[model samples]
Target: MHHDLVDGVPVIWTETPGPLEATLMFGCGLKDETFRTLGVTHLVEHLAMSTLPRLHFDHNASVSLSITDFTCTGRPEQVVDFLARVCAALTALPLERIEQEAGVLAAEGSGVADPVTAELLSIRYGTQGLGLASFNGPGADRIPLDAVRETVARHFHAGNAVLALTGPPPEGLRLPLPPGPRTARAPHPAPRTTRSSWHRADVPGPGLLLSCSLDDQAMLLAAHVLSQRLTDTARHQLGLSYDVDGTAVFVGPGRGERSIQLDVREGQEQRVAELLWHEAVRLATEEPTEAELADEREAAREFLTDPRTADLEVAERAADLLFGETHLDGETKLALQAEVTPAQVREAFAAAMETALLLVPCGVERLTLGRPDGSALPAGGCSERTALPVGSQYRPPLLARARSGAARKVRLVVNADGAWWQDEEGLIHGFPFTEVVGVEVQEGGRMLQGLGNCFVPVASELFAGLGRAIATIDAAVPEALCYPASALRATG
Candidate 1:
């Protein structure tokens, strides 16, 4: 591989025989967006691509959790033309067409990760940063014009981008993005939960997420082995599932979230969910055979040594430079994986699972998972208390209480410097007003999103006589932390 610079943008390149494959990467994506401006990154990407003249080439662009890329495979001149047009579009975005592009974006739907995996991120990181992956963010049209300009100024610039090519830089290639210094990203919010547990979501099947070092070779290989085991048992052996998808997204330097999601056959959701947990725990406590480990190593060898993957390797290097990740060449990475023993894989997977989450679909009931200590994995969500704290409390309006006994049991407390609610489920949810990151302003009341994915609703319909609590919140929180709910948001 070789490295150079094109008009101030870092260029990482390599030799390959196929039509030149080029990818221009920027160091920002969904992780950089706010709930109010959730689809802004996609909007920026779309706005750029929309300006490109019709071309007969396999070119496309995408936004992921932490980065975005514009890629194409074509003749050298086509590569040059594509990158130039993309850069020019960014430098002079056609904001007049934002409404047109917003419609396209909403129709395109979410594809960054599968449904189960995306929701798990939200369950782990609240409603911002990586957690934004699960939300549509009001709507694309709601993304402010100022936000677009700021994103371009902050991200799509020479200092924040890298150009990776399957072949050497094409003749006359140029990157004319705006001039700006590389921006540093704040670390993502701390995880909402860090122990063995389970949660339910709208999904086809179940998934397991493990937080670990990005370069943990053993756990990486172990996750691969578990995927194989699940595929073998669930797909081929029991016929309970049709496919198992896996994803590994880096969240910080030397840290990432790895997951395996399986698709359940009809009437088999519960069985598939149980199978996922059983396979994960089984692999953690029992090491895979030497033969099984060899299969994964050989697969790695094929992938790393393939000439067709040269462009991918280069793109990965670009991400490394952008994110400050420790870059290991193909051979070095393989060498590290080769030294990992079965016992090492077992121990690593076991330790990682101690801080893992099992996500099952919402309709599947009676599903149970246990910690290594044999106790049931606690249900995961915002609730940390079974009862409300003593405070000046509010309750449902008389009409609601008279109509529904469950409403009678609900209590909304707003004293002791914060507000909380004990729902009919009898679980308390909320944070101190100071810890509240965002208070989504609704017509009837405010919905607060804060620590541990807690969203407490102080609304007129649910709890009456909240004027004092609302006033207390207004006095305590920064004015900047409050915003009206998105126009496209579902009626609360």
Candidate 2:
């Protein structure tokens, strides 16, 4: 399902029966108090979700560089009923309450502590008459109830609002039409104008962020190509980071500027920063390898094969559509990606690299790069060496343990599952069938810790649990639990 606001806010919604999921999205070209209002709106969204009765399991929300979305997943039947209630709550949310608005501000402020994240935010934007960080400093949290009320009063104006319903849009769900041509007083537009021009605001933080703008129609196609190439090069080839990806094109006609920014960590900030700059320069000066270009095309094709009924993907795609992105079905992105030549990528890279490069350092007192002025390369080129082959005679077993420290430890095979393990400390751990992949565990050890896998979604939860578990393990023995090869096998 798709709906368009005359004011240019468009929404797309999809519904599926299994494991019900729903997402509410707000597409706005944000600036000034817009982000503050979004912060409040998000808080209200959470409060609204919490108020729903019989809501089970996952309820999440995210505010990104361009869009803010609220999502909830649960039983199908309950979700249908919940959708109506959510719309009602959104329409009726009280933004005039000072206490409520204050709570929202506090929450947004608390989320900004991470150095890496803060740096990303700082560099992706620029301080103009509009200011640097979109959601930065005390003003970000200083929005008053009246300001929020005023913002909300104009927020859901007919042509400026989007309401999407996924998962069996209620048997008889009827959305209320705005009284008239709903339109808000022109708010701030997003920061992208054309493919050739990019804008970013920076604040003090660790690491470096480089942004380059592209022409309008070209930006999306360029991004699809650039993201795939960079990710494959950085992660699969250079082993720079666990992952490297790009943001979907955010600006459109009369929306704002269109740009892409690359983020590098603090420890290797200088080296990575230089590498990124040099790569951009190199790509601009020359063309990508045919293999690199081909790989990007292949990945993009694979990405568009089929859309899972997942709420997050649906919401993102819907938002992209709202922003005037071309809608393609089934591997169209692949064809588009494939059509882009190494020369085109090189040309786009050269054009974008012209944007001003900014640096923000956090946590560290100062940084001294071996090549501070962007000269010199790491001793070895950024190429990854293949992993050493494991001996055929050795097959390691999966190890699970409940550690006493502030780290929640749960070891599971990637794509295979077997038995659950419980430590003497009463911590329950298990590999729930789908965790294992093609890799097999080999040569298990007792005391020594081996870095297995790092998944952000899981790590975030594990660490929280670890913190709590650590406090309880006063004298408990930290057992090293191991699962023999026989213990892991595909389940029927």
Candidate 3:
């Protein structure tokens, strides 16, 4: 490996047998934006990539949960030209082209991560930071101009970026990004809700999320082994599911979530969910066979021994530098992972299962997924308050309320204090005026998203005569807390 400084940007590279490939990476992604300004990072990436002239070489850029990378593969001159254009674009973005690029982004769609993984993050953290993944936020078109400029100033700079290459820097390569301080996330968003629980969402299958130290190799191996067990039983045996997917996402310097989700056949949701839970429990209790450990270790060996991964290694080192994480070579990681004994795996998984959040698909009849201790896994909720505060009460649309008793019982209250909704089942989703984050200014109404993963839809579509309620909310909340409904987002 070799290192160099190109116009104040740190560059890490290694010679490899291929067309030269280089990635200019910045330590900013979805986790950096507020709920109202979600997609700003992606917008910035699109705007930068849009400025490049047509080229015959293979080149592109992407923004993930933790880093944004602009990459190209061709002659070294192509590499130098691409990096130069990207850095120049970042220092002086073409603001006039935002509208056109936002449309392009909207057409690109919102499938950044697996839907199941995104939902789990939201449940783990609230609707900000990593939680922003699950939400569409204000959509690409609604992202404020000030948010874009602020994001660029705060994150897109020489101090916050690293460049990785498959070979030494090409002559004349220069990264001329503006200078700024390095950025790290505020101490990890405190886990919003208690875990070792379960919930239902509009997902295609069931999945499990466990919070653990990022360095827990035993837990990591257990996750892999458990995934293999599910694939074996769910697909090879019962034929209840097809693919069982797993991923680990970084949330802080030394912590993160490792999750596994499976896609089930219609009518098999309940069975598949039960299998995931039971298999995870089995690993938590019983030690796995020697064969299982050997299988996973051998798989790791096959991947790590390949020569093609030289470019990935360089990029990973760059990300480690960007995030202030300790970077272990592949050999060191493999040795540590291999030393994780079966007993250690059981103990690690058992401890982690206590922090697990099981996700079952929507539309399945309510399931009583029990924990390893035989307790009913509790459901995730926005609030625990039972009673609505004293305030003016608004009922559902008069005609609809008149037709159904349940709709008649629906109550929404907004006053000087705040707003809350009591559903037919009597569960209250409350949002205090002071604790409110952002309010989507919908047509003829406002929707309040608050702390504690709660929201109140004060819209006329659900309740009639909302003019007074809307005025009360607008007068009570800060003007900066509201934005027009996202142009590309269909619902609140």
Candidate 4:
């Protein structure tokens, strides 16, 4: 293995006794984009590879929260040529294909109907940079050509890129990337809701998803330990879940996101969350046993010593460079893993649990769990809004409001303070008029979503006055909330 620098870009190459593989990584992804320019990076990625479909070798591109990876494998010559073409394509972006690429992304987004990860990001980050992850990048299609060009020029530079090779170095590997300073990781946006708020979604399969950000080595190790405990409880003793796993993503120096996920039967969603949290509380306070920590350390050593594939090793090396981490071989990594103390991991767990976000599959019923003390979410209330304009009012019939799987009929009242809906049991749910997130108009009625993760439906019977109601609500909220991408497409 060897590390070198081509121009200003970092290159990590290794020789393996197998097929040749190469990957080119960039330091910009969804995290680099703002709310208004959400999909600019993805658009650039698609456009860059839009010209490479004819290549026979295995080639693909991936865009993530903080990095973009482009990889190809085949004979050394084919791989090198493909990479050169990718670099050239990025240097001189084909602006003519912007609209075409935008259409592709739009179609993909529409087909998926906003994925869970995007929804989580949106709720966690609001409508800002990292928060834009939850959105479908609605403004992607309208981004101007000049803005796209500028994004490409700034991020697709030698200083902000890494190239990794496994097997022999590809011939004529000329990455004539343009000159630009390395881009810094974007700061996270201020969260919009309670740090430990609960988000619910109905997925094809039911699962309990817990996510939190870890900013140090202790936290990372704690995440691993916590995940291990939760997985054992959820999958082994509980007999409720089919699969459980923990994963980590390092976004920047001493900063990353980690998640503990569990797939379970439909009826056991809440129980799964409860059990997971029970184990989390225990780990946070009791500290991991030395044997357990040693087991984790040994597992790390095994994986590092026996990487499944050469391609994986190269990718990890490149990722380390992208996140400003020093490269470590198997022995060095194992040594570092051993240095993490049980108390440090326990303390990390306690801190992480304080800001944890719980996402469960709550069909129609809202699920709330008692978090550990001192880590409870702060109190919140209905947002403030001016009086509803006179004549901008309606009482719509109840229709099914889409949720996990079930919803109930409700009455919507638009008054001075904002809008409040009465559920089947006559429970009033108030959402400040000014805090409306987006309004989705459907065949039977219009679904109104709020800033605090509430959804209500106004029946089609009120369609006669729905237009007036929408206008009135739009008038009260910020201009951005007036017409969401989904609402605009629906109304148009």
- Global lDDT of model 1: 0.85
In candidate 1, list every pair of residues with a backbone clash.
none
Error of 4 at 370 (Å): 3.2
- Enumerate residue pairs that collide in model 4: 118-134, 122-134
Better of 1 and 2 by TM-score: 1
What lDDT score goes with residue 238 in model 2? Answer: 67
lDDT of 3 at 213: 74
lDDT of 1 by residue, 309-418 (tens): 77778889988988877788889989999999999999999998898889888887666668766888888767777777788889999999999999888999887577
Q: What is the lDDT of residue 185 in candidate 4?
A: 61
lDDT of 2 by residue, 1-492 (tens): 455432243445565546656665554323323322324444444444545666566766554444555666766555545655665655676444445544554554544223343334333332211222333322323433555455455554334445454544544443342343433334343332112111122323222222443233333454555555555665577666454444333333433333234454446544544454445455556676788666655664556544553454566566555455555544454555656776777666555544423333333333333332354322211112222112111111222224333222323121112213322333433332232211111232111111111011112222223222222221121221221222212246
Q: How much does candidate 1 score in TM-score?
A: 0.92
Find the number of clashing residue pairs for candidate 1: 0
Give, for candidate 3, the lowest lDDT window spanning 10 residues: 483-492
lDDT (0-100) at residue 300 of candidate 4? 72
Candidate 2 structure, TM-score to reference: 0.57
Q: Which rank order by TM-score, best down to worst?
A: 3, 1, 4, 2
**Candidate 4 C-alpha lDDT tens digits along 1-492:** 788777677888888766778889998877677544667888899899997659877898878877887898889888878888898899888788887888787766641112444455555555555555556534556555666887898888888899988865665767888888777666555556535656566542222223444435566677677767766777777778876665454435544556566777678777776676677767767888898888888777777777555567777778788777776656765676678899988877777676566666655255445566735543222333223233334543234344312233445576555666655544555576665655544554555666554545555644335665555555665554323343224342
Which stretches in model 4 have alpha-carbon errors above 4 Å?
106-118, 139-147, 204-217, 307-310, 323-329, 364-368, 374-394, 397-492
Q: Runs in model 2 with CA error above 4 Å?
A: 1-17, 29-40, 43-54, 94-97, 104-141, 163-168, 176-243, 254-267, 309-313, 320-330, 356-492
Q: Distance from true position, residue 323, model 1, in Å?
A: 2.0
